[model samples]
Target: MPAVAPTLPDDLREDPRYYLRHFQFVLDWVAAHHDSLLAESEWKFIVGFGELPEVSQALLVRMVSRKGELFRLSRLDYAEIGDSDRALVPLVEAGMVIRDPLIGLDELFAQLRVPELRQCFAERLAAHGIAKSATRQRLLDVIQEYEEAGDAEPQRRRLSHWWTETTDQLVQLTVMPVCDRLRLMFFGNLHQTWSDFVLAELGLVRYQQVDLGELSHAFQCRGDVDLYLALHDLRGRLDEGESIEALLTEIPPPAQDNPWLAERRARLLYRLGQQAQRDGDIPLALHCYGLAGPGEARIRRLRLLERQGEYAEAHRLALEAQASPCGEAEQQGLERLLPRLARKLELPRPELPPTRQPRARVLELPADHLVICGSVELAVRDAISHSDRPAWYVENGLITGLFGLLCWEVVFAPLPGAFFHPFQHGPADLRRDDFVARRRRLFDTALARLDDGSYRDVILDHRQRCAGLANPFVHWELLEPELLSLALDCIPAMDLRCMFQRLLLDPAVNRSGLPDLVQFLPGERPSYRLIEVKAPGDRLQDNQRRWLDWLGRHHISVEVWHVEWRHD
Candidate 1:
C-alpha cells in the first residue's frame, strides 16, 4: 500500500493539494528570479538535492526542520518503513549522511553520570518520596521509563554529510525547484497566501521556541548547563544594566578540569576581557587574559600592552609569537603590530639586498596553447603531470609540504601568548618594514632546518598532528613523500627551503599567487624551474608579483608562460 500522508488539521485538510500547488508556485517564482532568490551556494545545494530519490529528499527536509544534524534512529517516524536504516542507506551511499555505528544506551546516559546531574536527578526522585539511599535506583528506573516513552516519538538523523551530491550538474538543476520551495517555506515572509497556510500545515517552519527541558541533561551535565546559562546572563547584564564588578561575580571558575570545561571557562573569561577592555579596564582585561586560553587571550594581552604604550614589551611578545602563530589571522595581526611597536621603540630593521631581475629568462608558451577549464595554471599542471618528464603541479603544495616535513618542530611550536580567536579581522595597521625584520627568524629557522636531515621526520610526524586541525598548511596527500623527496633531492636545500620560508613567513602577502607548476630535470645536478602560466586576458596578481620578485632576488630559476588559445 502507498504510505499515507499524515492527516492535516482542519485548515489544510479542506484541500490537500493546496500545499503542493503553493510549493509549485513558489518554485515558479524562484525559477523566474533565481538570481535574487538564492545565493550561489544555496542554489547549488538545492539543485543537487532535487536529483535524489523522493525518500532521500524528504529525509533531508525533515532533518533540516528539526534544526540539528544528529538524529536518533529509534525516534524516527518514517512513513515508508518501521526501520529507517535501509531507507537511509541510499543517503549514506550518496554521501549525504555519515552512518556511524549505532549509539548504545550507556553513552546516552554519560552526562547524567556526572555528580551534579546525578545528584539533581536523585534529589528529584527523592522529592517524590523515594529514600535517599535508593535515589540512584529510583532515578534510573524513572529514566528507563522516560526512554521507553521517548523512543516512540521520531528517529533523528546525523548532519555531518559534506554535500558530495552537488558534483553532478544535471542533478543540481533538477533539484532547484525543491530547494526553492524549502527556502520559501523556511525563511520567507508569509502573508495571507496558500503557501503560508500549507507551510504551517506541513510544520516546515517553526515559530515556537525549542528547549529540551529535562532531556537537556542527556546532552550536557549540570555544570556545563549552569555555565551556559551564566554566560548568556552575563551577555545580557553587560549590555543592559549591570556594573562590571557585578557582572564579574556571576562568572564562575571551571568546575571540572576537562578540555571542554577549560574551553568554556576560557571563552567566558575572553568575553569578560573584551568587555573590560572596551570599558577601559586594562588591568581587568589583562587579568582575564591571564586565566584564558593561550590562543586569543595572548593576542588580546599583546594588544593591551601596545595600547598602554609599552612598545618594547609588545615588540618582544610580537616577535616571539610571530615564529609559530596560533592561526593565519593571529599571525597577520602580529605582523601588522610588530612594525609599529618597533618604530616606536627605534628597533633596527633587517637589511635586504636590492630586488634583482631573474637570471633565467621568462619561458613563453606557444601562441596556440589551449586553455582548459578557464585556468591556464590547471592546464599547465595537467600537461606537466601527464608528460614523461619528472614533474608535478607542486605550486604552493610543494614548498608548504616540505616546510611542514622539515620545520615541524618550529611550525607547531607553542608561541608564547599565541591563541586562536575566530572571526578576527586582519590588522588595519600593516607596515612593510616591521614585517621585513620580524620575519627574519622564521626564514632563518626554516633555512637551518633544511640543513639538518632530522626535520624530515618532523614533517612526517606533523601529518598526524595536523589532521585534527581546521586548516593545515600542507596537504600531505597531494605531495607524497617519494615525490617530495625527489623534489628536495633535485633542488638545493637552502634555496628550496628559503623559497618555502618566504611563502610561510609573510603568508598574508606571499603565500598564494605562487608559480603554476614546478618541473625537475633529470641529471647529475638535478635542476628545477618554477613556471607561472597565464592564459589570454589573465594577469599576475600583486601577491604573485611579490613572490616572483622575492624568487628573482634569491636567484631561483623562475619563468612566466603566456598561453594563447588555439582554434582547431
Candidate 2:
C-alpha cells in the first residue's frame, strides 16, 4: 500500500500546545502498541507524567526536546508554559527533574561564560596568582594545574555552592534516559528523534504512511531492545576514542539468530580493527580482524597477514576466500591477492580468468578549459555533448533514482521490523542480506511492470506524485523531469532490469561507483552510454573498475575517457 499523505487537524495549527499533544501522541502510541516492551519503572513514568499539570508537561517536553539534560531556569522561557519556576515545581516534585543537582567542575565550566567563571572561581584563581582578565581556557588550565599539583580530588557541588552570588538556578532533567528508551521503541533506532514529528507537522518534511500492522514492531522481545541499546553504547564508546582492549571486552558476542544485530556487531568490530591498525598494534589488529564476523573482516586479515610477510597463511586464507567470497569487492580483492600470494610462496601460479577492459579514449583539451568548466568531468562532458547526444555528470544518481522510483512500494513495504515509525526515510533492513529475500514477492510484482512496458508509466507517475519524499536511493535534486524523461526514453527496460538486479545483489555496495556521466541519444530506437572521466594522472578506482567490468559483461555500453591538458 502507498503511504497516506500527511494531514493535520484544522485546529492543530491554531493550538499553542501542539508539541505537547504530539509528545502525548507518541507516549500513547507506544503504550498501546509496545506495552510489553516497557519496564515497570517506565510504566510508572507514563502514568505519573499524565497526572502532572499541563504546564509541567509542556515544560518537560520542551526540555526533553532540546539537546542536553541541564537547563538554566532563566534561559528556559516559553510563552506556552508561563513561569517556568512554577511549572518546574510539579516536575521536580514528581522526580522528573532535579533542582540544584551536584555537578562536576568540568560541567560547571561548560555551563558558565568567562565572566561567570571568573566570578565563581575568583577565590581559587587569586589564591593561584592568576589574572582575572585571562582567557577562560587559561583560567581553567591554571586552576586545574594547581588542583592537580595539590593532589586535590575533583569537586562536585550544587550551583549555589559554586557561585554564591548568582541568583540563576539550574535543573537537570532525570527523565531523558527513560524518554530515550521510549523514543528508541517508537522509532526502532536512536538516530531519529522528536524533531521528525515536528518537521512532518510543520510541512518541512513528508513521509510515506506505511501500514504498520499489529505485529509491526522493531523488537521481537525485551532482550533484543536491550541488546540494541548495549551495542549502540559500545559504538558510542568506540567513537569517543575509548581504549580498544577495554571496549572489545565489553562488546556482546554476535547475535547468531539476528542477522541485523550480527551485522551491527561485525561493523563495530571492523571499526575497532581499523582503529587498532591505526594505533600500530599489528597483533591486536590481527586478533580483531580474525574475530570480526564476515564482510570485510576476512579481506582485512588477508591483507594484514600479507603485510607481515606471513605468505603461507595469507595464501591459504586467499584460497579460502576465493572459494566463498563475501561480495564482489572481496572477490575482486582475492583475485589480485591470490596471484601475488602464490608467487610469494613459490607455488605454481593459479590460472585466473582473463580480465575485460572497457573502451578507452584520450582527450587533449586546453589547460585553461579546466578553469572555465570548473572540473575535468564537466569539460569532457561539454566537449562531447552535441545536439544528437547530451551528457550529465550524474555519477551514481540517475540509475539509483530510477531504481528507487520503480521499487517505491516494495521499498516501503511495512514488513515486521522494517518500519517502526512514520518518519523513516526507508526500510530498516534496507541494506541487510535478506532485504530482497524477505520481500521477493513484492519486488517481483513491482519488477513485472518492466516486462509489460508499464515501468515507464509507473516511474513517471511516482516522479509526479512522490517528488519530494525522502528515499535512500533517489536524489530528488538530480532527477530533474527532463533528465528523467530522457533516461526513460533512451535506456532500455531490459537494461534497467539488469542493472536493478545487480543493485539488489548488494544494495549497500553496488549502489556506488557508477560511471561519472551518462550520455543519452533520443530518437527512434533511442540509446544511452555510460562514461567515466579521469583527469591527468588519475586512475580507475577499485569499485569503478568492478562496475565497468560488470557493465561490459552485461553488454551495457560503457567507456573510460582520460583527459590530458595541452601544454600550449
Candidate 3:
C-alpha cells in the first residue's frame, strides 16, 4: 500500500538487464491499469510503461516533455515471456497479441483491446504531436550495424558507452520526438538490446502485419502531416548531399586539383556565363565563358544565344565552339532548355492568370462542412480533416489531431500541404491531455493488426481502393473518391495560388454530383463525427452555393454534426 519509489541500477547506463527488467515493469503496469487505462480521458497522457523505479518516473517525465518516442518504442526482447527463445519467441508471442500488416484503420482498431498480459509494448502515441522521424531510422540503422557486426566488443553490452552513441544519434538528429532526454538516459528500454520494442518501433515486426504493397496507399495517403514530414525528410537527404559537397569544397578531395575536376569546373563556369547572357547580363555572361578553355560551358553559351533572338551572335559562337571540348552532363544541357528558348522566339510571353478572385469568403452548410469559392483556409482545414484524422479535438484537449476523434471516416483525404498551424498555437481543448491520450490508446488498440505477418493483403487492398485526395506531393489527406463510404459531397477550394496553369485542373463536378465532406455518413453512421470547418467568418459566394446545393442533397440522410473554426 505504500507509494512505489522507483530506482535504477548505477551501472544500468551500460547494462541491458536493466532495460530487460524495465520493459517487464511497463508491460505489467498496462496490464493492471486495465480499467483506468481503458477508461482514460481524452486530454491527459498517462505514463506507467516500465517497472524500474527510475524508469517508471523517467517515462512519466519523458512523455510529458518532448522526447516521447523513446517511451513508446523502447522495449526489451520480451525475456519476460519466459525468455526461452529470447529473440524469435517473443516475436512469435507479440505477433499473437497484435496482428500483421498493422497500418490500416481496421487492423489498428481491431488490435485495440489485446489482452494486457499478451500486450508486450506500445508507446501510446499522442495525436497532438508527431511520432519519431527519419533520424530514428538512421540511428536504428547504426545500432543494428554495430550489433550485427563480427568484432563484438564483449564489454559493449555491459557498459553504457554504446547506448550513449545511439542516444547521441537521436539527439544529433533532433528526432527525439516530444519527450525528455535525461529521463531516456536513466529509465526505459531504449538503453537495452534489440527486443520486441525495437522491432515494433522500427516498423520491422510491426510492419510484418502490413504488406509493403498494402501500405503503398496509406504511406501515400496517411495524411498531410506524414507527407510534410516526408518532404522535409527528403529535402534533408538532399541537403545532406549538399553538405557533403560543401565539405568537399573545404577539404578538396585528395585528388588534389585533378585535371578531370578542373575541366568539369571550367565547363560549369561557362554554363553560368551563358545563363547570365540570356538574362540580358551580357557582359557578365561573356566573362563567365571567357576563361572557359573549350569546356562544355562555352559550347552551350553559343547555343543559348541562338535560341534567344540573338541568332547572329549565336551563329558566331557556334563557330567558335567548332573546336571546343564538351563534357558529359553539360553536352546535352543546351538541348534541354532549348524548347523554352524556341517558345519565346515564336511568341510574346504568355499572359499570366489574373490575381483577382470572383469572391472573398467561404460557405458553411448545415452539416459542418465548408464550401469555399474563394478562401484558401477553408480548403486547407477541410483537407486536413479528411486526410489524417477523421476528426480532431474540440473539447478533450491537445491529444487530438485537428478535428479530434469525432470523425466518421470511411476514406483518406489528404491536406493540400503537410504542415498545419500547430494546434498548440490554436486552442487548449485540443492540447495534449489525458482524454486524447486515452483515445489514441483506444484507437491504437482497436486498430491493431490481427496477424503476426499478414498485413500485406489488408493494406494493399485498402490502398488500391483509397481514393483519398492528395496531390503531386502526397500529404496524408483523402482526395475525392479515396473513400467508398465517406462520399464527401463538397467543392474543391479555389485554386488561390494559380500554380496550375489551369486552376480548375480537375473538371468541375455537376451540381448533382458535388461532394460534401459529410454526405456519406452511413445510415447517418460513423461511430464518431466532426463538423466541417472553414476559415473564420468567410462570406459565401455563388460557386460555393452551387457546391452546397450538391452537398445538401445528402445532408439530411448522413445525420453528421458540426463545429467550424474561422480566424475572424
Q: Which candidate comes out best when scored by TM-score?
A: 2
Give candidate 3's error at residue 121 in angstroms: 46
Runs in model 2 deviating more than 4 A are 1-12, 126-133, 367-374, 566-568
Candidates 2 and 3 compared by TM-score, better number: 2
lDDT tens readout by residue for model 3, 230-300 = 33343344344433222222322212323323443454455456555656776666666755555455555
TM-score ranking of the models: 2, 1, 3
lDDT of each: 0.54, 0.87, 0.30
Question: Which lDDT tens digits does candidate 1 get at residues 316-407?
Answer: 87788877876544654665677677778887763333455444333344434443334566666665653335667767677766665565
Summarize candidate 2's per-residue lDDT along 1-568 as a digit string, tens digits: 1133223354466788888887887787788678788899889899999999999999999999999899889989999888999999999999999999998777788889999999988888888788878997897898678667776687788999989999999999999989988888888889988888778777777787788877788777778778889989989998999989999999886665677877778888888899999999999998888888555888888999999999999898788778878888888888888889988889988988777789999999999999999999999889889878988889999999999999999998888878877788888888787889998999899888999999999999999999889888988999998899899999999999988988888887888999999999888889999999999899999989988888888889999989999979
Residue 478 shift from truth in candidate 2, angstroms? 1.5
Name the 10 consecutive residues with the lowest summed lDDT in model 1.
420-429
Quality of model 3 by C-alpha lDDT:
0.30
The worst-scoring run of ten residues by lDDT in candidate 2 lies at: 1-10
Q: Which ranking of candidates, highest lDDT first?
A: 2, 1, 3
Candidate 1 deviant stretches above 4 angstroms:
1-374, 381-388, 414-447, 456-471
- Cα error, residue 267 of model 2, in Å, equals 0.9
**Clash count of each predicted structure:** 15, 1, 99
